[model samples]
Target: MAASVDSPTPAASLNQEESTTGSTPFLRNGTVMSRSVKISSIPDPSLGTDERVGESDRAKRMKEDSLLLLRGFDSIAQNLSQLSSNLGSALQGARYLAEPPTLREIFHSRIENSESRQEEVEKEKIEGGKNTGLKRKFDPDERSEDQGNDFLNENEQCLEDKKLKKAKNLAVSMATKAAALARELKSIKSDLCFMQERCALLEEENRRIRDGFGEGTRLEEDDLMRLQMEALLAEKSRLGNENANLKRENQCLHQLVEYHQITTQDLSASYEQVITCLDFSSPTSSMMEEADNEDD
Candidate 1:
């Protein structure tokens, strides 16, 4: 009885082992399915509040970082657009400087008029002086007065001629200087175009660098791009200052040209007045001679 209680018979033991083996699969399957369902339905208790807080903080940081990147990209885009607009305006200014046909035409016409007027004045003076001197014989005292008046008038005419010549020379010089300035403007335009191309290349290189580095070197890439943008901004400011200076110089040149033109016009008007006075004086002198002949 003690042996039976201590150890089961082999058949009975074998039967019990077979029943346990047969029930183990169902138990394991039910327990595994229950545990899986529990895991799927419930939050993990092992994930602490600290870990959740850390995850939330990390998400917040990522969102903030994305916003910052978007802002930076927007700023960069605005800067690029401004730079392009500046370049375009500069090109337009250069083009205007290069092709000043209207100014050239005005200068040419004025110069031609001055030359023709000068020739007409010279011919008129020579013919009128010869005719007046040969046509009339006056009393000795009257002749002396006439000669003195003629001498004074000739001196005035000579001075006027000299002024006209100076004006013509100045106009010619100004035209030549304008041409030189135009050439310089053309060179500046070319330089600007080269700078634009270089900027484009730099932008392409920056894009390539960004693509190659992806997310790993994001901070380093931002720093590098920031430095590049700063450099570009500095260059743009310098160019803008130079452009402003050029504009000022162009305005000064235009003012000077206008001043010269006014002076030339005034001088021409004065010359016309002198010619009209001479014509009026000639008729008076002939009447005086006729009066003198009647008195004789």
Candidate 2:
């Protein structure tokens, strides 16, 4: 009994020494030990025996570890790439906001001008003589009511013509812009989908790498990384929608601008044609009359 106890102690001590050194093999009972619970009956623990390695070499483990380390770095690089892409996209959106759409600017300008014209017309229509008690006593110098009404009619016609042209221009611009926005939205959605697919592929790669590393480890900060990725995905989706909407608006505005420009050109051409056809042959025709009067 004493000898048997001493033998077990030596084996235990050898195991301890090998485990500490790591340079030597750490032993475990092979099939022999699995066959019985009797410790003494077990043969040499050949779990680390050289025979198990056939075509594969032990040095392959070092290469595998190095490869795993490389994969970890690759994952980190991918994460950085994702972060950069997000930042770039946000910056692009900001840039787009700064540029705004040209059609919107033109629309604002046109609306402001219309308001001013309306205010001027209202101020003119308000009878100045009654309010200020500054009654005019002139006959030849002052315009008759009929003449004043005629002038007002001309102004109204001019303003109405301008408003009609502006309306037609605005309608055309809106149509053009809508088409452009639709195209832009489609492009942006395609890019976003591609990014999502890339993200998924990276996640799959990470899972593959983790599996290769064996499951005994609780990866550090994996939860945090996953949460961050989720947040990024959400942000990306939101941005994609916003980009699509903005592009659509931009397209609509672009069309409006083009339509207005076309209408403005057409109106200018018509005005030129009318001016060309106007007869200036009579001495009372202001342009001809001015020359004839100047001669007298």
Candidate 3:
């Protein structure tokens, strides 16, 4: 009788130890242990077979649920990282667009450089023509007059054709560059208008925020605006922290609920097995008591 009592005590201790170590593994091991305990303790073969089968199914379902939660967490983390990256890129673009001086200076410098290059090209063409004319005048050709005239006309025609081609190319390049600059200027003007409207909206929002604080504070507009911005940023950070904490708390609560559910199932199964054992032993216990009384 002592050995029978002690056998169950060791199994229960082992179950407690397994439960403390880990959740998923403990659930599986506990279910198996409970089934074994039921089979060993209860003499009736068909009492808890269906109940044990149901418990095993529940354990499998809980395992699948935990896996799904883990997958959800992973997907959420990936989405958060993507959102953070996109936000960072958007901020960088906003900063780039906000600075007017840098963009204006870059475009102005490019226009100036193009103009200077065109001037240099014109000067080089003029210098080359003058040099060729001087060389022609200085040269004393031994060829006949008609031959020399024909050669000079052919050379002049070729130079004229080359100059015309170069001028045509320069005109095309300048026209293209001018069109590009005009488009860029138009875009800049639109951006400036947009920024102006945005600034106006921001000013309106600032006025509304300031009004909400009432007229009790006697501070400069800039100072008050700065303070308001600081307060808003602090509030945003606090809310973010609170949201993160809530998520953590929710996860913990879910885990606790699952643990309690498993514990409750284990307890209920143990209770049913104990009842069965007691029921099966009752007649034998009564018979033993009767025999003892007769012996007495």
Prediction 1 global C-alpha lDDT: 0.82
Off by over 4 Å in 1: 1-139, 211-214, 217-234, 268-296
Q: Which residue pairs in model 3 clash with each other?
A: none
Candidates' TM-scores?
A: 0.45, 0.29, 0.26
**Per-residue lDDT of model 2, residues 1-296, tens digit only:** 55544356788988875665565333334433454667666666575465567325656887899999999999999999999999999999999998857655666677678678877876875655344333334454444764587677767668666866667566646755665766777997787788788778767766765675575545555665567568767867887788777867777576666766676666545454656878756555778877888999
**lDDT of candidate 2 at residue 107, scale 0 to 100:** 66
- What clash pairs does model 2 have? 173-255, 173-256, 174-256, 176-255, 177-251, 177-252, 177-255, 178-252
Q: Residues 1-296, candidate 1, lDDT per residue (tens digit)?
A: 55555678899988976776578798757767887999898876777787989999999999999999999999999999999999999999999889857656786888789778878988997898787676555344466777889898888778887887788778877888787888888998898888888789878978887787765667777788889878877878887887898888789789979988888777856666767766455878899999999999
lDDT of each residue in 76-181, candidate 3, tens digit only: 9999999999999999999998966643455456657766876796698679668766766776463356457757765765655454445444444544555565
TM-score of 3: 0.26
How far is 238's C-alpha from truth in model 2 (Å)?
26
Candidate 1, TM-score vs. the true structure? Answer: 0.45
Candidate 1 residue pairs in backbone clash: none
Error in Å for residue 232 of model 3: 40
- Winner by lDDT: 1
lDDT of 3: 0.67
